[model samples]
Target chain A: MIPLSHFMIISAALFCIGLFAVLTKRNAIQILIGIEFMINAAILNFVAAGRFDRVAGGGQMFALFAIVLAAAGVAVALAIILNVYKHFRTINPDKIDTLKN
Target chain B: MSAEQLAFYFFASLTLISALLVVCMQNLVRSIFLFFVTIFSLAAMFVFALADFIAVTEVVVYVGGVLVLMLFAFMLSNKELLSGLQNIAGGFKFTHLAGLLICGGMLFLLVSAISAADVVNLSWIKNGQAISENDNTIHQIGIHTMTRYLLPFEVVSVFLMMALIGAAHLSRRERRS
Candidate 1:
């Protein structure tokens, strides 16, 4: 049987990678992609931990709710990004300086 | 190394590699496609972890719905940004280096924590038969969603409806402007 630590390690690595993307990427869509990666990493952890909680399946249930929430968030975020592009004419977060003083 | 172990390693590597590519690739469209690979491998990993229901939902919602929406948004937005050459056209800067350092430190901390932790294996295992017999996850999830998780489930549905309306409202072009 594979140790639970193995899954944890993979998820951790995935989360770091996602964080790196979120920090470095200038494009709003790229940042959103990074955020999606982070969410999936968390979902991986939930499912892996859920394997041990066989009776309640709380982990799986949480993962399900998380997935739904992520989808909804992505939809809303993309809409907002689209609106930003409409006004700023650029999707690069670094270039959109309208809010700056 | 058994079949399950082998499968786990394969999917895990696939997920990690594609995730790295998603971050490294500059082309927005290509990055989105690589994101597809990342999500697909993650779904496979979910199956290996015995969350078959979550795996299917991941594919349907993430790969099918969210991905398609992202692609559509990308296409509908600025035409100049469509090509790979023009997307993210810039040199490396200080932020990239900072991100590397931060992420490297975080990875180190997380690995140490995982190594230090003691994960108890539940006695629910009965010669592997118990694991195989516990395949009624879908039924269990359904029952739990209707009972213990009913409130959250209803809230999620309402939240989804709100998001749909919000997206539609936000994306509509203004007449006066």
Candidate 2:
């Protein structure tokens, strides 16, 4: 059997990549891509840990909910990003700092 | 290595590589398309982990649903604006390096913690009844969703409904009264 920690390491690396993308990517859509990575990493962790809860399948159950919530969130976020694009005529997050000035 | 180990490594590598490509590729359309690979490989990983039901859902919801939605958003956002704009995010820079450094440190911390903790020998794994590898998780998931998971199931449906309505309202072109 592959060690559970191996799974943990993979997910951690995935989360880090997502974080790196979020920090470096100027475009909001790309940032959303990063957020997807981070969310997947988290879902993977839940499934890994829930391996022990054979009786309830709580981890899998929660992971399912998490996935649904993620889909909803991405949908809403993209809609909002659409609105931002409409108003600013650009999707680069850095340049849309009306509140900063 | 055994076949299971080999399969695990294959799926895991596929997941990681596609994910990296999704973030690193300069072409937005290509990266988004690569995300299909990432999600499919992740679903494979889920199957390898004995969460077959989750695996199927991952493919259906992510590939069949979310990616298509993202692609629509990508097109609707307008090709001319995207193509005409300079892609500043594709370049390397000090800030990007700093972000990489910080995230790499986090991964390092997580790896060390997982190793030091020796998660395989945790009390729950030691004592908990392991789900037989062959037991049909789909059946159990169904029972739980209808019985124990009933409330959350209903709420998620409602949440989906809200998203449908809200997104339609939010994205529609506004008109002056």
Candidate 3:
């Protein structure tokens, strides 16, 4: 049996990568992609932890809800990004600085 | 290492490599495709962890639904934006170094925490006997969702509906001005 630490290590690495993507990416869509990675990394953690809670499967249930919410969030974010593109002609977050003082 | 360890390592590498590619790849379309690989590897990791139901849901909802929606949005956006390979003209110049430092620090901290922590054998087998057949996760999850988790389930449904409406409203083309 694979140790639980293995899963934890993988999820941690995934989370860091996602954080890097979110912090460094300038494109709105790329930021959204990073957010998805981060969410999936958390989901991985939940499912891996759920492997221990075999009785109620609360972790799995929470993971399900998280996945649903992530899909909803992505849908809304993509729409917003699309609207931003329409108004600004560019999806780069830095270039869309109309609100800057 | 056992077969399980081998599979775990394979999926873990797959997920981590694609995730790195998703962040590092400058081409937007290529990055999106790499994101797909990352999500798929994550689902496979879920399967390795024995969350079969979640794995299937990840594939259906994330790969089938969310990714298709993202692709549609990408295609619908400007043509020049799609063809350009260069990143945003002058963004991320200063932040790259800062982001690298922060993320690298976070990774080091997390790894250290995991290593220093006590390793408990949290595997599901209780006592000498395995969990009974009725302990099948899908069934248990269904029961819990209807009972203990009913509120969250209903809330998620409402949230999804609201999001659908909000996205439609937000993306609608302006007819005025």
List, residue by residue over B1-120, the lDDT tens digit for candidate 2: 999999999989988898888888777888899999989888887776678889889889988878988888888786665665344544678978899899989988989998999999
Q: How does residue B83 of candidate 2 score in lDDT?
A: 61
Q: Candidate 1: lDDT of A64?
A: 99
Q: Taking the candidates in order, what DockQ does each have?
A: 0.62, 0.77, 0.67
DockQ of 2: 0.77
User: First chain TM-score in every candidate?
Assistant: 0.95, 0.95, 0.94
Which regions in candidate 2 have their CA more than 4 angstroms from the true location? A99-101, B84-90
lDDT of each: 0.86, 0.86, 0.83
Ranking by TM-score: 2, 1, 3
TM-scores for all predictions: 0.91, 0.94, 0.90
User: Tens digits of per-residue lDDT for model 3 on B1-177?
Assistant: 788788889989999998898888877778888878888889988887778889999999988988888888888775787556474544556699899999999999999998887445433433223223345677777898999899999999999999999999998878986
In Å, residue A85's CA in model 3 sits off its true spot by 0.8
Prediction 3 TM-score vs. true = 0.90
lDDT of 1 at A40: 91
TM-score of 2: 0.94
Runs of candidate 3 with Cα error greater than 4 angstroms are B82-84, B87-92, B119-135
